[model samples]
Target: MDCHPRGRGRGRGGRGNRNEESRDVRLSKSLSYALRHGANKMGLQMNSDGFVFVEELLAHQQFRSFSLEDVERVVATNDKQRFKLCNHPEDGRLQIRANQGHSVKVTDLELRAVALDDPDYPREAVHGSYMKHWPSIRSQGISRMNRTHIHLAPGLPGEGGVISGMRQSCDLAVYIDVAKAMSDGIQFFWSENGVLLTPGDAAGMLAPCYFSQAQRLKPSPCEIELH
Candidate 1:
């Protein structure tokens, strides 16, 4: 799905929240933290495909007070579509998993690569990041770092400005040469929200030269600037 991103952070476009909306935002972040980075500590075990039983997840002490309805509400309303719920292939039990951008280990999320020549492959892609990291990224290329894959957003080539769906922490947009990267053997995957993911190169990371251009963005005056 071409879902837009949502969060308590900036860049996510939303107005003042009602009590229910506030709770959903809070719950969504909590879910991301637990599933993508702290499943073990959250007392849940995800199978190789990065899936955990929804019932098991809700049973955790942190989530025990929340009902299945609450979980479903958050998933349904989440703008980013970060979490996905599906039926377990083996049984009929409901399961949940983070779509991509995982920092913690997940054995087999099954994110395979798409060819550069694929019709839907974006001509240009953008990576959101802080300006502080630009120098290193320019020299070494984008890395997944602790995450499972490098997260990217699709944009049109020759687009002169920042595209949508950037993270609040980002002040810079790095444009990627998707076709060139793929031709150079870098593989790309699509997340549930249409975010692009790549496994990088043989060294397990993207090289600096693959980044075609970058630009720093100014925040809107209405944005609540955070230090």
Candidate 2:
């Protein structure tokens, strides 16, 4: 569930207080764990699209105590926009799912592609990684590992794409050639928030040759910064 923390506020004139931040962090972790990798064990039945009924989620042991309002707030306020709350078209019931970052074998979200005509469609993308993994990545390419798809970050003209694999220890960013990748028959899917998702090989993932550039960045050295 690509459930990374994004800065947010709790109310007018205030960022999230410690209590609110702690609560959200705990809830986000649990939700990501359950929905992305353990829905069946949790007794939450996800549809082919990875959506589970809101009622089912609320009834699940892990989240039975959380109100619908609480769930909605978490989904809406998530920085990465990882989870989505939607209305089930057929049943008209409220449903929710992790937008991407799934490891379980389920139907793909089959998200729509941003039209090339669209102003926000990205022509290039960025992926964050670490130097230590470069040898493997160069030789075998970026594999999905155990995850369902290879995630990519596509920032707007002046913005930076969200870098994965660079948190805490990663120190490199790889630039992607979106047009070239597409020309070679690689397909890319953009989530609701613009993160790119690729239907990678079931057994492996993208090959390193698809990446056009890799550069290292200095990691923060302060003890406080490391934490």
Candidate 3:
């Protein structure tokens, strides 16, 4: 559910063809791509809740060689808990969807709305980025870009309940003023996997005014000028 896709490890000691581990990684990435961003492009009939039939998905060219067990393995073994598998409400057919970080529109994906004073609200809401983009971010605030919502981590990586959302390689961290933003009509939602999501203001931008603090977190911790 991080902004940037995380890299997967290739299997070691493979002669020519990819090993089981390598194949699993490939299937995971493919599933992420299809479920998160390209279901429509891949010709999969995704519902408004962002779910597609597992059988239909497997029928796609990229997944033709894969079986149901392979998908179950990827979903079960994924460290980030990115995918969710369930049965269709109308019928009993199995379906799958991404937990969060969707670029394509998904109207109802089981996200819980968070209030500023609510206990479910994240104690720390941070957006991660790189130093190279700091200047632009300082001026323009945080843009959701092509994503439907801006992703935020509840806490830094390795902290409790901080499994995904922000990329580990990010050098800069922008802390958001959740109370202030909510008071001003900005909305926040919490995903099942503990990712904080915001649609931002009307223009889909979290303005600099709502940023409580900015800091360089990698190499060494250092404060950055927000004003």
Candidate 4:
């Protein structure tokens, strides 16, 4: 997977990813939570800061493969009000000025978030709820986000910002779904090149008995279907 890193993120012509050296650490964090805690169990809900709290507990890197771009797209669609934060959708295109400069072409921002559902990402809780369970998720792994308290970003609720937070700064909100890991898990691959499909839709959901029984979360992986 080209685990070798290129060092800290540098602002320039192009930065494909953030801290590449942190890949294994990040993936380990993600896998640890999904297997041990069942992040999906956390009843997913969007906070005003533009994050969806998946109380079940998740790893730091669950959404590693997922781009900040995905987060931006979801906010625009999931919460209609978020559009106010955007430049203005025209011809179904999300056009916005960037901090670096130049405009990035965002097509169907709504579909972006929807596509992330299947990236096998860790559940994300708000600041308060995440902070309350932060100890467990980071140390042992396990959280009940519904009952946990968290903090809000205090930033404008923009879907793009949400993504930029992760992919760029890799910071938007604090998530605590790191269920105590210590075990191997499953990996889903496409039948072909995987260019035609992704685990991003309802089908991407990875719900399981352990997720429900141990985590007490919902949206069983069974609810989703395979192509």
Q: Candidate 2 on 1-227: residue-level lDDT in tens?
A: 32333233344223356765666677788888877899988777888888888888888778866667667777878767778877767667888888777888767686776454567666777666677877777677787777776777774223564533123345666666777666666777776656687765444567666777676655542111110
lDDT of 1: 0.71
- Once fitted onto the true fold, the runs of candidate 3 whose alpha carbons sit more than 4 angstroms away are 1-18
- Candidate 4, run of 10 with poorest lDDT: 189-198
- What TM-score against the true fold does each predicted structure earn? 0.79, 0.77, 0.88, 0.17
Q: Summarize candidate 3's per-residue lDDT along 39-63 as a digit string, tens digits.
A: 9898999999899899999999999
Q: Write candidate 1's Cα lDDT for 1-227 as tens digits.
A: 12232223322223344665676677788888888989987778978778888899888887776667767767666656678777766676877788886887676776656775577778678888887887777777777888777888885222443232357567777878888888887888876567788878876677866777777765631222121
By TM-score rank, best first, the candidates go 3, 1, 2, 4
Q: How close is candidate 3 to the true structure, as a TM-score?
A: 0.88
Stretches > 4 Å off in candidate 1:
1-17, 110-112, 156-165, 220-227
Clash pairs (backbone) in predicted model 1: none
Which prediction has more favorable lDDT, 2 or 3?
A: 3
Candidate 4 C-alpha lDDT tens digits along 186-219: 2222111011111211332222211211221122
List lDDT for all candidates, in order: 0.71, 0.68, 0.85, 0.25
TM-score of the candidate numbered 2? 0.77
In Å, residue 162's CA in model 1 sits off its true spot by 12
**Global local distance difference test of model 2:** 0.68
